[model samples]
Target chain A: MPQPDVVDDESVAAVEAGLDALDTPTERRRRFTWRRAAAVVAPPVLAIVLLIAVWQALWAAAFWPEYQLPAPAAVWQVITDNVQTGVAFDVLWNSVHRAVLGFAAGVLIGTPLGLIVAKVRIVRAAIGPLLSGLQSLPSVAWVPAAVLWFGVTPSTVYFVVLMGSVPSIANGLVAGIDQIPPILPRVGTVLGASRLGSARHILLPAALPGYLAGLKQGWAFSWRSLMAAEIIAVSPQLGKGLGAFLEEGRNLSDMPTVIAAIFLILLVGIGIELLVFRPLERSVLRARGLSGAF
Target chain B: MTATLETSAMTTAVRLTGVHKSFGAGRGAVSALEGVDLSVAPGEFVCLLGASGCGKTTLLNLVAGLDRPTAGDIALSTSRPAVMFQEAALMPWLTASRNVELALRFAGVRRTQRRERAGELLELVRLGGLGDKRPHELSGGMRQRVALARALASAVQGSQDGSPALLLMDEPFSALDAITRDVLQGELLRVWRSTNTAVLFVTHDVREAVRLGQRVVLLSSRPGRVVREWQVGDLEPSAEAAAIEEINTSLREVISSHAAA
Candidate 1:
């Protein structure tokens, strides 16, 4: 058929404009008010308060000896002293630096490993099961072996951290690649995207959620392995970390110091999650219109 | 007539001769398309009408170069033929404009020009000012329009002789509501007419085929072959209705005959 006349074009555009006006959803931007902030923030704050209250009550009730399960104030005092002396910063810096370096290395290595395994049939057949197995194995289990190989040095901690994270990161990528709808790659092929172009533009982006989830898990593993390595491989060269601090508290039989160290560990874990992964996940999911509460 | 024929041959968008495609080998082998011969002229609007299991999609894949034909020759004037799937297939991570831009990027458009070109394509699809919206943000019909824009972006500057490229659409509007489908059909017609791109639209909807196609080819089921063809050029409304009814009757006969056999 010939092209529509000018009048037809005008009317068609009018009709389309009308259809679009009706069909397009109105965006009601939910303003983040103080009330909304409180709604989100109050629960966690209240939970911590409630826990502290319970701990105080337990202390008052004398459920355990003061030396065995130190008072909240004693633990608080220990934390304050560490902060005041700048020891807390040193401990956190040591642990965080190792965790970041190890995780970064894990990402660099795991990404290509995952890509190779995901794309190459022979590599997948050879190592797919092994990757899954490694993800399940506790990184702490590698601590003794890592110590034996690298000695009681920073390398031992890093070796343990890598072992903990690499499998999770690589496996996460593989899972992400696997979950991609078959039609997506076909669409890429039809669009005439070269293999590398498709990987960059299509495959990696499609697998982002899975890969992010893997990174989060990998971080958790890295932290855990670092702690395990530090606790076991106690050396003067490896400056005191949170795990070493906790071990020191144990050796000194100081309940307050031990509790303070444990609290710092928990605080760091939650802080990293909130500061890094949660926002990353939220943005990624929101962009994809999958931001509904899970 | 001889001169016109020569021109047609030179300007052919795609041609498939004795094209055969099968799924597997040995006892498990299932043929999808067998000895299929077809040709699409430049700037033609052709619809392939067939029931489920007729290998309409397989034929499109073969032509799009996503898959090779098991046997026989499939030739295209352009190496990169744009394709739109049933689903919009817009990258979830990309906004509507970015999705279109990605296509332009692949089509070898310079980075500096991609954003502007993507915007123009979006405007061509009547999706102007909604380029920043992601696929999930847009309504189903709107997403399909974005997909249409992306397809158009991929087609731009595709033909070496500066002619329009081919677009293979596989039931792109089948997933939409009737009202949305109607709107999109009109939009598609407008786009096709303006761009002068050859489109081989595959669908089972006879009404849609008659509504949009300059020519409609019917395919037989289970190892699909072209069973019939209809040229719907320059028909009046009443005559178009009559043509639709005739095609529907023939389609029913084809389906029933297959059942009986």
Candidate 2:
């Protein structure tokens, strides 16, 4: 609160008046103009187009043997061939179902666990290191243990995905809660927001950016864990997933099918991130004027 | 016209006796408020002016019941005093209207009535059409206006007879540009006239304190003892603007001497 040295009264008054007059009036618009929308979406779309063109050129140039790196057309043929037979849809659905279920479980378990660890010093001290350490351990590493625990069933895949994703989601929540501005909690208390009310209105909303980040990571972990479980702990009764398709491609030496499976997995992961979590993150950060950081 | 005299006879709006607040413990202990005594009558505007570390904010907190006074008693005849911080403190997720609606909601206003009440409060602060806009969408002045509207909305819903709901402002207008601050001070006086909510404003601006408060209370730095009090009746808005200016100049001299020492 250091005050600047006083200048001539008239000059200071003029400058203050100018600053007052310069305050910008905010505009209200219901819908994004096409130009504005295009401004935002154009770059990513252009990058994707550039990428596909490069991929196609590499295939045409015969950069690698067909048995190693299949052509785009060859991968497309594998997709069309399996899709017509309905097996592609079944595998996609199976993987998506497992990922969704695992993500839900992780969120449910992790949110409360995060709140406890964040609010209580003793609980955080006891489990904080372990939670971070668990995040570092790859989801794929859990497949063997999950197979032993659940005996090569669908339950094993579910367990593996949950184990992989839960720590990240919980840790995200804790980080989000921790990062909440100290001013907000004080404001809530003064406004008569009780402990539970503060958690609901102030703590939860403030932590949302971090929590959403965790959710994005949780989904990735779930997808990775399911794929690992399907490939390593395969059971016909558990049905086919993208990992199973990749495994089948390896057995048959069909590089095109393997490439198609890999592409599908990559596409889905990116799609979920863009369509779901990205918007959520953008909205939260934008509300807080932190979108500039992005 | 004598609303202050009328209301003072009714009941004490806020009474804080021997209030003490300290942070940390043992060797690291830092006292924020030490044996402070204050009583704000209904409809009175009291400004607490001091340098940094003067515990102005700590005193405000004690009255708001946000934190307990370590050694003293605080009694509010009405519900808890509504607080306005230096920052707007509006919820970013909510629109300006919904921010006001939250206060109404907590005060037990019916859901159907909240929208109209929120709109009315917005108009009270000259932000009539900006209710749908989020905090980010508003300028700093507009955001603080919304915050003032929200605080007023709470007082309206919560205040009881005799003891008007107290509005504890912790340098709410300090961050604003001078014109906006001037406009808001005018708006606050108008609002105070209508609602009769006793205001306990904290500021380091001596002119601002003289302009806004019926009585200005000066606090010493650190443990924050009440050092002096000035009755600023002739400087009230009802007085001639020239007389108020002269009062402001003298108040600035007092503050400058304090700074020099």
Candidate 3:
């Protein structure tokens, strides 16, 4: 027969009472409402509106001559005409398609390469600093090498994109793995987890925020590299990518088209960040009690 | 539970003999433990007591198989021990139930069974309704209880050919307020009595050692050796006060001499 100790039930009951009264310190997620949405969107909207007003005022004042700073009306006319003719849509589709393909390829190559490098000391020791060094080299600098290797082909554009992005993705995973607390894996080990199991269950999940950060950076790199390659290695074989379009406008001295392309690039970059990366980072940060500050 | 009780008559849960640990090699080597021997038998509640740097935790780590002893024999009849660190060490991404379920998952429990078992473990810790909450959402004491639940899950799991379970707790309630600590101490005793798992608890508090341990082993500082041992398992609550005072007086003497040195 098993003998049980007569526990201090009153004390247990007391703590039980205290448990309910213990103030929950974790902040409840701020509710999303129309008002909150407006509060968030209002400032940015005002800033953009103010920017357009200033641009119109500059055009009215005829600052920097018509050739250098085209009238706001002329820029608007270009955007409206492109929207109607669907030339802007085709340019966007072509550039975005290339960027998407290159970015996917970068993720596939970089994620595994990062995992291997982060876990294996020999690999990390050999190429850790080399990888970070690669990040500092402008992706545009790869245009010449890519053109030499693949000529004026889509393969050349992708080659530059891969060189630009792979390092960042690998670097991010390494950073994420490094930042995981040593105790978590130690705890995992004592719980009878194998080395690989510990890394999977504890290290990887803990390092998710950092990996996501890396992915976001890698996308930016991919876009930049694609544009650089497009500008340098422009060919009808590569299609009318945004970079080639911008280059063409420059060649033709059509200032409005160049400005329009610039806007499109900024919008795409901002859209990915807002639509994809921001939600990912927000959920992770909020779970870790880091959302408020970070 | 019956299996653990059956092992009580013969096998020891963990045995450490002449254990020595040094952090660095040669001239800079700082010894943590030297010529230490300790053992906890099946279903035993043993507490190792010492001040900071007394190598209590180092010894526990060695026993838990987290580190290797420099020159000693350490044995555990149990397959692998479960550890509850001072910090909760809960996965922030997981809910309380999922955190417990992770141990079950590692143990190769059926996917369909994990959720129910995890819920039962959470309820065992008196955290029944709070299973869905995140670690950050809970109070410090609640988090530690969930951590304790996780440790328990590990203990009962992965027992192949019926190896006994050993639980290593490193000052698990030291961060809590005095009242919460007291309540948890009671809860621990109650749980220990029910579960029949061997516990090797490490703490510096003499009262806590006396309160929780069937056998309290006091270690001396400076490369930590076994200084004294007490079998205080059968004391009454009234007698515990005097016993605590006696232990405190001896600890004070040891501290004074060290301070004078």
Candidate 4:
């Protein structure tokens, strides 16, 4: 027999270290810096400034009459007036509180509903198409039926928000569950995980990106549905929300207040997406090495 | 079942008796393996060789308890066998040591001991300092090493009465480049020797089977059945040129017969 070369721990370690050096990629750690922040923040701020400037020019040119297409300053003045009187906080609080409560309820209902739809074939066959159909049908259309059922109470607003949000949340979870690679569950099984154990350890974490996406979409739907309810389901007992304020402006022919309400609605929508969901999604994606772009 | 019981005195890591597996039922049924009878003794290294569609992976899956056979029986000494796939199959979201810990956890290791044991397992695979790195951060070879550590942890967990663990590997090195594969095969041998685990390694590479296995078993292609076996004796299979040539010649005959059929 040919004498085999002596195998030692030292030589193996040396060989492994050499191979690793050749193969290990030098990773560039991207630090969060002021310059990166400015790069992201600058464009949107500049766009908003340009929009105001164009509005001012249009008002100066008297393109449509002052009452119909009011100056940007007039809309700002209306917002400032509401803030001074503390009406902005009150109306903002009422709408936001309703949205938060409705979203929480939707999550409770939608989670079990999603789990059932994803796992049970018979249940999925029966209601899967219905959930998808409900998602496409505008939640605003439910406001009229909600008002008729609940008679402009807080329940009516919550009912409309739930209708808008549930389908989106459930469908998002179902889609996430569907996207998990088949190898993952098989790996779990071979590792000796039980069915429940696999779901807890493997399936849920793997499905997070999809579930988070569903939650973000569900929030958006709830907000839109709440606004529709506030505007259409009018009663003296109902607190004045941004949507209600906009409706009052239309009744009194106050264009500045109408524009102000529209701006507040846009601001709140973008704020929640930026402050809550975006950071959460970015972290989850980054942890999994799925984040390629900022 | 009787065949396994008959061999109980020597004790085995795993034994398959008259194992048959089929994919579907009725008119469209496809058989993958037929009448497969194989066994791996504790701490023995056996390589299962065959052409593509020879049901090597199907046999491993049956041994791993991932699937039931259409007929016959498979019995194992341990509660479960550790399995390694062509891909590392580590969870992307977990760190390397954490991935190893997951297997330990499933094997019912206490939380207090899991971290320390996981570290030891990583050291055993020569992945000592890279434990905190995620799967994506490691090279393909490093990821496979972590997977090896995880498999070792699983084996330790399933072992009973100081018995050696059983490991099922399905072409675990096929995806690697030549140099990495050589390094890993050497590493695997070292690990296998020190740990004293029984390994049922499946591959289509004849040279690899000869290089690693104490005994090499050959299966005919399509609805695979054991066609032949060769004992490499005490000398290294690589050094035994006559034995290597004999096994290769038999393998060629099996492939040609497949073509003819």
Candidate 5:
């Protein structure tokens, strides 16, 4: 397309946008800008500092004794103590392994379920409301039933995690499929695409962002459910995961240790989101030009 | 070569007979097309001219196999046609090349051949060197051109017997600005001439119909049926002015009579 001598503002914007897109290299080469980096890193750091300051102030005031509300330093000391003994790392690893394994299972089970619900009208009509209803019911509700079925073993925790995440993954896929523009199917039909061919090429790719969002939510649910099962269900066979560690601290009325375990759980959840989901989302949005900038 | 061209011209690319389309049923049913009959010979350009609710789009949809007629037959000599809507329906996620390649992939073009063919088609539309850009990155006119490229790719890749393509465009350039529309129309004419594609171009614009179509078919509103038609060949500037004047008179009469009814 050539530039016309006389152009409107809208056309000018379109041309500029097109030129920007064309100029983009095959590999994205973003310059390291300190200001932009600071814009991302500042808010969370500031919030943590503020939260600690508030915790210290209340501790200093001796509000309801140190046992009930430990000082920030007390929790910090517990983290350092356990980390020095390498118990913290081991505990963290045990919990993450369960969540990741269960999340993988959720992906395997839920994806096909989502597709089936999306495409098969009869299946969707039968299972649709139940799937959503299951999502709303916290995975903790399934612990007792899972224990009765699988007993106080690692399988109980796995079962609970699967229950927690599958609905979200399936429902996410369904929503993604629903968002596909009707034109894509017509395009496929005209171009002589078989139903399966179009499903592979057009439907799946178009529904990806929504599915990614679902996967993120599914992972969160998996972690939460695993933690819940670990807290409630006692297993001599199972190692002390974060949930069990927190439970042990409560049993002993060890507030600082409990708070440290809570922090570790939060840290892992945040780490996975930052390391995995954020990058996935940013790249997707950037490719589609849905992001504010490349 | 002349014999083959002559034979192709004599062959009917599309034929719609006694096509009746009515939405809903009984008392509330709205009739769109009643007793509509039309045909396009291979290599012919026919513009369906009508007001809103005149079943021009409905008729096009019927021909494209997107929808079926309530009563009647629509026969096509060629494979399924390539349709371009009023809105350029380019997939936003794919780059310009990939969008065209998607049609090629569906047309059963091998992975090895798709890229070169896509590049060739893009070059044909004068959209060379911009294949990697996404749909939103392109201007409205450019997007429509990519859509045209996709439609062309579909036609070529389909049938595989080297059949002359059939293109059904529903007000494809109506959304564009005046200058951009003129530029695209010229490109369209060039492309059409090169491919010898049979086209059924629908538009509400009378001047546009007279300007583009080899023959303009006037369809009446409210139960659309062919009211009149005019053959317009070699629209030199002088002839274009006279054709426009005649089309305007007939168009106004159609609108006025519909309003009275």
Candidate 6:
């Protein structure tokens, strides 16, 4: 009859099917674009460069006396000299060892204490305020009591660090538990999860972000407490830590050595935060979709 | 359609009698529900349609056993009724399949057959290949599907007496787009027919109530009580679109009159 009746029912059906297939949504892959990576990394590197430049310019202008603000080169010289003599390395090792031990102890004692306070109404009401109050008290204040109790030994330093950091770690966990969305706990109940199982599976995971935040703050406290203990409770029996190095510089009136020690302390604190805590925080936030970038 | 009309009291899956609930105490007390009586027979789909302060959610909560009635009682012939919320409520940490598996596990599904049952449920909801994906990775419609599948799994695993399962839904499709809502309504009907579950759905949308429910129970404003009930006939595709419009207009009139009062 006609020239194929051009658009037959079969042809029309085939066309519609093709359009449906085209309209169907497909999952797309998400990638970490290098441009975004560069954008994130650039600002910090530039700021560091600017800071160094400003310091060098101040030194060039001789704005402050060398005794007050030592030049970058002078501080570098002190680091090199101390390294060659192995003193800087010893001090670094001593400070790191104390900080690590303090952090471990804080986590151990604080985690359980937090769980108890969060779960039990009586315990929370009784000790919650005390825990937060203890966090505000300066770790240096513990030095005298620790010395009176343990004498001028590593144990005294350890005691001071624990008193300083444990409260913050525990409070963090308490806050974390408080912040967990109520839905999760309900889900846990529906699933027949026992109290312990709920704590382990639902409550803990839900509280992770808050807990990590607490750990970050706890580490800072640990570091600061160790330094205070090291400087104030110094003895021949106790090894030289970063704080002791700064004190020795003060005794000798070696401005460059003091600057070098301060620089090392700042560097190590930033390094730990950036390398360890930041990545942990990022992963947790991203996993929960609380962060902008996955 | 005929099947729903023929449902008898003997086939009741869930029944609530003289249920009363109130918040606060003494002089300041606000009643949320009062003397509420309702029943859903096996294989029936009932919608509790109401305005904002109508206690529809409170009623569903009682049925789900999330909260107990201040007075009276709610009884189910089988195990606890499964509930679905406006939000998908899937655990963010688990894959879609694992979320369904969790419900099955809780309902005492055998350990060896849990995965297979979960997979079957995923297929039932048309999310067969999405088992391993996290909730965040799925679309809003997809997440709700997983939620529906999870609720169904719980119902299936726990339902005794060979009766249809009981489902309590609190506006499960309120968050979806119209197209997605339509698709999910179809899916809901398919699943309901296949599983023969008795659904007590709560929604503010009148068209949705007419589209999905065999019986629509309208509730009065605060201190909610049954105000009116309508038995909607078969919403066959040819007449559904027109019927929905007419029902929506009437629902709008009812809401406006209540607002004016």
Instruction: Candidate 3: list runs displaced more than 4 Å.
Output: A1-7, B1-10, B158-160
RMSD of 1: 3.5
Sort order, DockQ high to low: 4, 1, 3, 5, 2, 6
Alpha-carbon runs more than 4 Å astray in model 2: A1-22, A25-65, A286-294, B1-10, B236-261
Task: Supply candidate 5's per-residue lDDT for A149.
Answer: 94
TM-score of chain B of each: 0.94, 0.86, 0.93, 0.94, 0.93, 0.89
Itemize residue pairs with steric clashes in candidate 3.
none
Least accurate stretch of 10 residues (summed lDDT) in model 1 chain A? Answer: A1-10
Model 6: DockQ vs. true structure? 0.21
How well is each residue in A1-294 modelled by candidate 6, as lDDT tens digits? 111111344443344334334434454656799998998899999998898889989988988988887778888999999899998889999999889998999999989999899999999999999999999999999999999999999999989999888999999999998998787777666555567777876788878888888889999999999988988988888889999999999999999988899989998899999899989998788656566654
lDDT tens per residue, model 2, A143-188: 8877778798988888889888899999999999998878888877
DockQ of candidate 3 (2 decimals) = 0.47
Summarize candidate 4's per-residue lDDT along B69-155 as a digit string, tens digits. 899888788777899999999998899999999998877789889999999999998889899998888889999999999988888
lDDT of 6 by residue, B15-101 (tens): 777888998899999999998888888889999998888899988877776677788767675565677889887877778998898
Report the C-alpha lDDT of model 1 over A1-294, residue by residue, as the tens digit.
323232367777887787777878666668889999999999999999999999999999998999897889999999999999999999999888888999999999989999899999999999999999999998889888877888888888888999999999999999999999998898888777899999999999999999999999999999988888888889999999989999999999999999999999999899999999999999999889888752
Greater-TM-score candidate between 1 and 3: 1
Report, for candidate 6, the interface RMSD. Answer: 10.1
Worst 10 residues of 1 chain B by lDDT: B1-10
Give the poorly placed runs of model 4, Cα more than 4 Å off: A1-7, B1-10, B161-163, B236-239
Q: Rank candidates by lDDT, best first.
A: 4, 1, 5, 3, 6, 2
- Runs with alpha carbons beyond 4 Å of true place in candidate 5: A1-31, B1-10
Two-way lDDT contest, 4 vs 6, winner: 4
State the number of backbone clashes in model 1.
0
Fnat for candidate 5 (0 to 1) = 0.27
lDDT of 3 by residue, B36-87 (tens): 9888988999999988888989988887778888888877777778899999
Go through the candidates in order and give each one's DockQ: 0.49, 0.24, 0.47, 0.51, 0.33, 0.21
List the global CA lDDT of all models. Answer: 0.88, 0.81, 0.84, 0.88, 0.85, 0.81
